[model samples]
Target: MVTLVYLSVIILAWFATAANADIQVVCANKSVSITWEISADLVPYAARLFLGSCMPSHLNLLPSGKGEVQFNYGFENCKFKKQIKGKQMSYQNEITFRPYPKSKPAAFVYPIKCVYRSPANLNNQFLNPGSVSEGRGSLVFHMALLNEQLTGLATTNVIPLGSFMPIWAQVEQKSHQPLLLLMEECVAAHTPQLHSGSWVYPIINNKGCLLESKQGNSIFLPRYHSSALILYLQSFRLGHEGEVYIHCKLTAWDPDVLDESNKVCHYVKETERWSLLDDPFQSSICNCCDSTCKSRSKRQAEQESRGLRHNFVLGPLIVVEPDSPAK
Candidate 1:
């Protein structure tokens, strides 16, 4: 009887271990990957497992009769939902398994989440309220060419013509009332410094209108916050070679107030109209985009003086023809 009891205990331990599922996850800048391991006892049910309505990208059968499945998908794909809370951006999804088609509920369910820092929160100095006004009472500003994932700076300076380029601009507004950032005007030139006779290309004109949107797929993406903006520009080659520089006039304004002179407007080809990114209901203010955007009156300028405006340069980006040889 004592020998039989020892054998029964061992059998129970093995069953417990086999019943538990092992899961691992890897989060990349643009995609998320999950690996689910199925024990030998549950290998038959592998077909029923799923990650947020997506099937396994790869499946392997182990020598030990166990099975492994991987799910890979982009953050915006696979029905993943996104949420922005304060300085954090989070993506959420779930893993589930159904034993039968007629089942009332999933037999297994596991919640999963991926979180990233907001583009405006990437700088550590912005976290400190006192540091924003430490010197000259000027706010800190940043602009960079982001990678395809929009998570960090681009690793390469080379860009293919007609490809979408992500440009991020942000301002530190710590300890101050909420503010909005706008690209009043932007231009592309061959040199970082503008001279009297330098040739230029207009990207954004008429105060805050994005002229490129009317010609190409370039437009402003949904803002993560009022203090930051992202421009998705369709790349273009200048002079057939060399480096290109982008010069932009950035303005910080009151969030509660958006007028024709202090707004970001992009043309919507589908609607055939200019739409204000901040407040679409106020898009009527964007009608002047096709003609001439009026300058701010003296009283309006004085009211906006509480905020700040500055010029920022981003560049040295090399745009090459698509048929050119790889660098």
Candidate 2:
């Protein structure tokens, strides 16, 4: 009886400690914040953040703002493996947007393209082998949220932190392939040159089939176009050696817009929940300009030198603390 009681106590303690595992919250500005623990009892999705604990809670929330719109994203490093003996596996790729699209009782949706890979799982379609997708990959979906699924970008606030999502994937046999997905804020720039798995599309038809909105909101069209990326992983076997560029194109829509600045990276603190960083497309502050394009019409006038496309005037390399615990 004493042994049973001790075991129970130990189990309870283990559970308590497991909650709120350590996580590094990074902002685009290259700032680092630490999230030591999370709890399902108090916070629900705490367990899902840890790659070590592969429970059913498969969601990574990226908070946007309070409006309805079709968020296109994919994960970069999502892996799967059979436990000991091989077991059937299914997974979910979900996104938890912030402010919950505070609109009507409509449907909200986020799509995922599951590229199933086996020892021979070379296809980008469903993992079940026999499953058939349109082209290179199989696209699945998670929970449908509000009525914002079909609409274009609308009037919204900055997506708060704590938002998350999941990608649902399954396989007949047991094999684990880390996943890589991202959400494209726009769809127009998705081209062969755009190395990212997702895209940011221009005004198009009902691919996402966005919903219609009312007058209270602005025209809802974003001038500085933006897309979201759902990075399901940190790394993958690209079968090659190159950079995986995660680029976002901003469309400054206003005709009178002047300050077309760019932000390389920034820090996101735990306290600043809805932190906003600058866009990364502008020239790096580290590099300098030259007179190379002296005569080009679109080039910067000699008087206002914005040298080398990657002018080395950049700030010091961002230093981040190691995420893992004591080895």
Candidate 3:
């Protein structure tokens, strides 16, 4: 009776130690890889792989020995390839992994480019906003700043004092991998005495304004698509009698960074900054207008005499003027 009881206990323990299937999906560069591992004891008699809604035989599982089995599939052989063959596909896709009756199906989402066009121009969308369009290689970027009246928006080189300005960005990507877009007010306020403290950092409305993410976290440009972001801005003082600059950059996401929350974007060569009060667009900002506006050619000479200078790179410059009193 004791021997029979011990044998029953051993049989239950062996069954509990049975093997299972594990799967992982990784997307990098312009490719997506699906990898899976199955323990020897749990090798399936038959297996099937489905990319999106299409189950191509090219990725069908093959017979394996009773040890460990592994398989990998590339994006070209997967759903994207089916897309090239004139098959109807959805913008959002999923990869399904299943092995006979022993395991449950595991699915991973895939992002596909649905529409590839420039977002509607914010200047045309907003009232009295300034607009400027810039490009590098195949990629293009644009920015628009709120005009003095606050009813419209456009791109401008000068930022006034004591005024509220709203800025918007537009980007078009021609790359295979997703691109990261970063817009920053690159003024260093801590710089000593040359009026560096006059400029205010932009407040981004990642929720309603930017189409990137609802959580205000990731700002990615989908492959072969264009996107836009709205920048929250306020200028308490003019950083200088000269121009302020706003910088825009695009890069590929880095996976090696341990902190997933940190926005780790590697800079590409196409980075550009929008200039304020730059050549052809010049203005003197003050709460009470005193000094006459100088041309771009003469402003440098005047700045030297005024003894006001900045040692940091000027980004998108906002010329702020005093607000009208409550009527």
Candidate 4:
């Protein structure tokens, strides 16, 4: 009877200790911050927590007698993967913290729910049947200019002329039904070179029509799969000046197929609208120029030469205690 009572006490103590260990995960910028608070009672037994595979890159542990510790892991180094949906980019990965040398039960493992949203001012279009689209499946389109240096950063509404602008277009299918698909892209003046799984054609039509490979329009997207087109172009035409409008149109069709029940016949026609300006595009900062471009440049140089520079040192300023020499 005494042994049974002692066993019950041990089981209860284990459960209590497990329940007290708390972990909190938060999205810090592009990285994830994982913090675990060890229960005071278990501090003596708690060792360093091991990340996945017990690799040195994932090892983060609390110092001796410390009750809490944090581990900040970059998205690339961690096991988590990134996903893109519409205008949002999210992380789909799990962080597992295991007790070193193995424990009675498993350690804490949880997924990090973090989403990075793109700017809301993108040129997005949703076409319905009879409007520009004729299909049972919902057709969606979006266009934006991505930063050359930082691919994840996007510029909206305006692009600079004469620059090799990187344009990103997204096409999503909301319906599960199979359908015959035809996709086409047309610029106002010169055709931009598209880079994707699909091909591009020189012939562009203002009226909505499916340009099949037989008919010369070679770009086609198969049904049931979403498509993303990365196009590049340098518009130096007559309308390449400041505040000039640049327009692009995308059209698709779903003609009647043999399998009527499996395929939903429809048509989609959408336009991606933006402007081409002479002012250079800058990500993470607003570009505000003076009335005259030449005047702004001259003033910018003068301000830089006369501006005061504040020399400052950035640091957390850590001090390490001296340890005794090992005998």
Write one digit per residue (lDDT tens) for candidate 4, span 246-268. Answer: 24443222322112111111111
Weakest 10 consecutive residues of candidate 4 by summed lDDT? 275-284
Per-residue lDDT, model 1, residue 146, is 75
> Which residue pairs clash in candidate 4?
132-269, 133-267, 133-268, 134-266, 134-267, 135-266
lDDT of 4 at 117: 74
Clashes of 3: 31
lDDT of 1 by residue, 165-256 (tens): 88877777877688788999999999999889989999998889999999888988766777888899999877765578998888777877
lDDT of 2 by residue, 180-262 (tens): 11111212232325544744332211111111111111112111111111111112112231222222222111112112221
Question: TM-scores for all candidates?
Answer: 0.60, 0.15, 0.29, 0.34
lDDT of 4 at 230: 37
lDDT of 1 at 284: 84
Q: After best superposition, candidate 3 residue 250: deviation in angstroms? A: 4.9
- Note the Cα lDDT for every prediction shown: 0.76, 0.22, 0.35, 0.36
For this target, which candidate reaches the highest TM-score against the unseen true structure? 1
Local error of candidate 2 at 171, Å?
Answer: 12
lDDT of 4 at 25: 73
**181-265 in candidate 3: lDDT tens per residue?**
3332132232222353454433222111221122222222221222344444445443443335543332222212112111211
Any idea how many clashes model 2 has?
112
Model 2: per-residue Cα lDDT at residue 105: 25
Quality of model 2 by C-alpha lDDT: 0.22
How accurate locally is residue 70 in candidate 1, as Cα lDDT from 0 to 100? Answer: 87
Q: Could you list the CA RMSD of all candidates, in the order they appear?
A: 11.8, 23.4, 18.4, 23.3
